[model samples]
Target: MLRLDDLTLFTRTAELGSLSAAARELDISPAVASAGLKRLEQQLQVRLILRSTRSLRLTPEGEQFLAHARSALHSLESGRQALAGGKAAISGVLQIAAPSDFGRNVLLPWLDQFQQAHPQLSLRLLLSDHVADLFRQPVDIALRYGEPEDSSLVALPVAAGNRRVVCAAPAYFAHHGQPRQPEELRGHNCLLYMLGGRVHDRWSFVRGGESQALTVSGDRVSDDADVVRRWAVAGQGVVYKSWLDVAADVEAGRLQVALADYRGEATPLNLICAHRDQLSKPVHLLREFLQQRCAELLARVPWA
Candidate 1:
């Protein structure tokens, strides 16, 4: 008989491209994961993966089985949830990923309250500016901004109305003067943030059926989005950031919006999963909680 554990190990190894990584996620030793994969291949009588010291790649047979394996897991999970009346306690550790700034400034306190509400549920959060590979990473879900480019992942709206804003500290504006229009931002110092090796210095906006873009320059730059926001709050330079990220700062009068009439880029927040099967009751509830919290936060300001 085939073991479900073996199937899970095989699928995770294929997705992560590392037996060790999959084992770490599943809370098993690398040797155990390797042995499980070997047992599974032996039972199926096919070469599943071409393994090497420094690399791991799925063979054609493994590639074909991967789809079926994921489907099977999904079906089993669905059955289990259905059997539990969809009221299963949201226990176990949920691994999540989010942007650095939002994770620290916004999500941290919210998650704390959420965990308090569900004492049985634990959270593992990965904070980064770079996008996480939903298929490859160990994270069960990710909180991201903007519409997801990959169609395979399931995206649930957390804050669909969220948008970017151009803002800076009052001290900086007092010294450099605030721009009344989008185009005038060219004369001010703009804090730049880099992601996936590209510097986001080009500020774009739209207002009254007109569109404008400006390539602003600044003395400070950081790959970490949180650092850029901090620089803006410290009066270092103007920043083009997600309103959800800077909403509290703006509300507290630490930062002031520039060119509020012009609408900046849309940055709709979402909770994304690699597979629909991953959307358990906990995930759905988390999405709703996030939506409400985000709505409340944005309501404090008229920027939404």
Candidate 2:
């Protein structure tokens, strides 16, 4: 029989694509990790991975065995949880990636409460506007806006009804006036956000069966969504952002909604994992907690 530790190492190495990364995660040295993989491969009588100085990839045999390995590990975990009377203590380092604005402004406090509730759990959060490669990166999960394009990944909805909103600070509206329609935005300085090297200057909206998408210019642009939001809050320009990102500001009267009659694009928030087996009990609990918190926050905005 294959050793469970070897199985875990194999899965982690395959998921992370780096022996060093897997070793670090497991708190072992690279030499030990290499020895374990070699032992497993020798027993199986097949080379599982092709490794070089700069790249690593699985063999076809390894690719086929990966599913069975993951399933076996998941089954063992489930059995262990059952042995604990279905209340296994949640204790592990949960590495997560999230959008910059929500991660810093919204999720940081909520995560603190979560950690307080489960003191045994640890967290590593990566905040960025760029999409994280789940297979290549060290993160175990991601909190992202919009549904994932890759249907193979599991996506748990945190806030499905959430959408984008056109907003600006009261001072900005006082000076430049609010754009009543999408077309009028061309005359205003719209704060733009950049992602994956593309500048998002186009704003789209729909109202009463009418749809419009207009490319709006801006005096400033930033790759970080949080920066653009701060610019908007500073009364620098108009901003089109997720309602969740701007909801508190709107409620506090720092920012006011523009084109309330027009419905902006949907931006449903989701918790994404690369594989189903990655959804442990702790992950499920966190998802539920976030769903409740987001619902409460969204409820405060009557127009959203």
Candidate 3:
């Protein structure tokens, strides 16, 4: 008989595309993952993976097994949920991933409140600017900005908000003069976010039923959004950031919105989770909590 634990490991490895990545997600050693897969394949008398030094691929047999394994796992999860009913209690560590600045400013305070409400629950929060692979990381849910490109995972929109106006310190605007059009931004110091190994220095704007893209350059750049916000606040350069991060400064007259006519639309925040039927009670509770908090906050903001 095939072991359920071994089958779970096998399914996770196949979904994640690597034994080491699966091990990381499962909080186990690669050796354990390898042994589990070996045992699983041995019990079935079939080759499952075409292993290589640098890559992993599922064999035909493995592919077939994966479909069945996923379905079975889903069925098992559904049954468990049905047995527990809707009032299942939660008590476990819930791992989460979120952007560094957003997590620090928005979610951290709310998390304190959430913990107070549920003392039995613990949380492990990972803050990063780049998107994390949920199947390769030990995360129960991920808070992502913008829509996810991956079709395999399930994404739920939690917060509706917009990108901030292109803004700078009063000093920087006085030194460089304010830009009237998107094209004029080329003459000013513009900060950019690097995406997908490229410096996204191009700014998009729409006015008078037309759209334009402005190419910009700057002497200072960093991957952290908070660093960019700090530089802009200190009169170092102009930056485009979420209003949530700069709203306080804007209200305090520390920073001013530049080229307000060309501001872009808001990007919605999303809660992402693996597409699985057996979500634990803790995950469900946290997801609902986040959604409720996000909704309440967005209600008070104009851009949201």
Candidate 4:
């Protein structure tokens, strides 16, 4: 009989593109992991992974096998969840990935509260401005500000009313003068943020059913979003940022919204998971908790 654990190890190794990384994630030794893969291949009578010193790649057979492997795992998980009646005790490592500023400032505290509610549940958080791959990484779920790029994943609506605002520090506006229209932003210095290897210099806004993308320039650019927020706070330049990121600064008189009448369309916040059927009990509970607490907060914000 083929062991399900071996098949799972194979899937993780294939997804991560490394045997050692998958072994480390599964808390098994490298040699043991290698042996398990070998055993699985022997039973299946086919080579699964093409391994080299530099990297690991799945064979044609491996690629086809992976789909069935994941589906089988998902079905098993679904059966278990059904048996437990959706009230299973939330235990096991719940891995999550999220952006930096929002993760640290907002979601981090809520995550803490969730953990407190379920003492048995463990957590592993990967906070980065760069978007994390749910399949490639070991994370069970991700919190993204915009729509998911990958169609393979399932995105749960976390916040629908969250919006991006064009803003600048009061000092910056006093010195450079705030722009009244979207086109005027080209004359002012605009702080830029780089995400996924592209600089977000094109600021978009919709007014009276017309949308425009204003290309702006700046002196400072950073890959880390939190640093960009800091630069905006220091009166370095005007910035196009999420309202949740600048709400405190705006309320405290540190920053002021510019061209509020032409604010950009709201982007939804999504809780993304790889396979809905495979979603763990902790992930389901976490999604519900976030929808109740986090989504409500953003929904109530006065965007105008």
Candidate 5:
């Protein structure tokens, strides 16, 4: 059987990327940390890592073993916390990953209140437009928009909202002329989003109970949603985006929603977590808080 101490040491080492770093995190000496890893490798009869003066690299065996070790460590720690009655409280680090736009405009602002409510909890928030691999990364929870393709995760629909109609600034509309039908968008300058250099230029529209999809081409394309919104605001081009993302600009008359009668389907936002038989108190609290907050946000949507 693998020792819990050795597993803990191994996980810390992998996470910190060096014996000295792991030692600092675990409150042990570098020699002790190195010795613990050596003992673990000896017991398993497999070399887990390749060390050099400049860097440490994981062997293929180590990469595979780390997954099992992380899962096991999580289970062991959870079990220990469960057994430690009386003071069985939620007081540990919680890591969350979310999309940049949503995280900035929605979630991050509310974190102050959550932090106040749970002062004992240490929160690590990672914001990126890219999806994070929860199993590979140490993320405890993720807030994702649109439908998730992965069925292995437990997803809770937390918010529902509509996608915005393609819109442009009044100045741009005056210069390019307004598109009366979805097809007319082909003649206009459209701001597009590029995912890894491939244009995500498809615009979905609903009109007279019929849905249509338009493939648009544009001179400017960006991976950043904010950049697309800014281009539309600056009268550079038309942009199809979520209302929640551009509602304030639309309200301020910086941008106008084109093809007004043709709005697409409401996208459901979700909170995802690793599937477990039981959830920890911190996870439970965060889920409830997000659910309530999302409900409140959705209720204020003008198109809802």
Candidate 6:
């Protein structure tokens, strides 16, 4: 009844000669490695390792287990690599769902390169703000802006440290006079973006080492984010949005940033799959490619 992960850890610890060393090599915390080893020992009703103040020595039984476990782990790893390796020749229509603005502005161009790299792979891009049901929809994967609430799907990191910004056109800021903090948003006309049939007017931020949220009011609301961006650029009102989406406009001086002191909440980007076992070689390639590209794009922004 030894856990597969614990067995892998046991072999790693045996090879490294120390639990902490194995943890470092495996990119896991020492406490987790220690607990995994303890779990393995308890399951087998055998003392696998003897721990000292500064070192680790395997019990006689542990040494015997290590030999068999190492061989088994190698076999399992070879099988996994084979599956991953089969991805080199991906030929099929890979369907991916993404948010409307990001999909159009960022992902569409990226997909063009991906198609070039894998000539045999046909692709279908589904763009919408509505969250796709991975289990029900005909989608192989999805790129999303925030953590999914559904426990059934696996969220893989595409990009991290993506923060939103509160901004407006220079003309609007000049007419209204820019208010300083998050609280001042109430005095201005805030642009609202509709998602899932509801208006998202609550803007979250961090001010003075504490988390704060403000429910903003505005004269205009639109389901299409691009429309909201357009309205903001036309000197209509303040808008809260992903910095990356507005990075070009902000840089081009189309919009001016507000509340520079308040830090916007980080909205991580993720590539989600319904099940790891269902992941094919194309999926693996796409996931890795986007992970790299998305990080690069997020890092392109310069903010105060």
Candidate 6, 1-304: lDDT as tens digits: 7678898788767756778888998899989998998888988899989999898888899877765675565456446757767645677668799988788877788899999999998998888888987653556689888899998778888787788889999999999999888888999999999988999999988877899998999899988887898899999999998876787788789998887778897878888976665466677889889888877766765445
Q: Write the per-residue lDDT of candidate 1 for residues 1-304, one digit (tens) a residue.
A: 8899999999888877789999999999988988999999999999999998999998888877876787677668767766877466767668899999999999999999999988988898999989998765668799999878899888988998888899999999999999998878878888999998999988888888888888899899999999999999999999999999999999899999988888898889999987888887778888889999999976764442
Score each candidate by Cα lDDT: 0.88, 0.89, 0.76, 0.83, 0.77, 0.82
Per-residue lDDT over 191-214 for candidate 5, one digit per residue giving the tens place of the 0 to 100 score: 987654678778887767788887
Candidate 2 on 1-304: residue-level lDDT in tens? 7999999999899987899999999999999999999999999999999999999999999987877777777668756655666465777678899999999999999999999999998999999999997755667789999888888888989999888999999999999888877889888898999998999987788888888898899889999999999999999999999999999899999999988888898889999987877787778889999999999988875452
Error of 4 at 38 (Å): 0.9
Error of 4 at 160 (Å): 1.4
What's the lDDT of the predicted structure labeled candidate 4?
Answer: 0.83
Per-residue lDDT of model 4, residues 1-304, tens digit only: 8899898899889867899999998999999999999999999999999998998898999988886787687678667767878466767667799889778877888989999999888998999988887655667789999888889888888776788888888999999998989899989888999999999988888888788886899999999888888899999999888877777778788888888788575767789987776566778889889878765566545445
Give lDDT for model 1.
0.88
Off by over 4 Å in 6: 1-88, 302-304
Structural similarity to truth (TM-score) of each candidate: 0.87, 0.85, 0.73, 0.86, 0.84, 0.68
Over 4 Å off in model 2, which ranges?
11-30, 44-75, 302-304
Which of the two candidates, 4 or 6, achieves a greater lDDT against the reference? 4
Cα error, candidate 5, residue 260 (Å): 4.1
Number of the top-ranking candidate, with lDDT as the measure: 2
In candidate 4, stretches whose alpha carbon ends up further than 4 angstroms from where it belongs are 15-31, 52-57, 86-88, 299-302
| Global Cα lDDT for candidate 6 | 0.82
Model 1 TM-score, 2 decimals: 0.87
- In the predicted model 2, the residue pairs found to clash are none
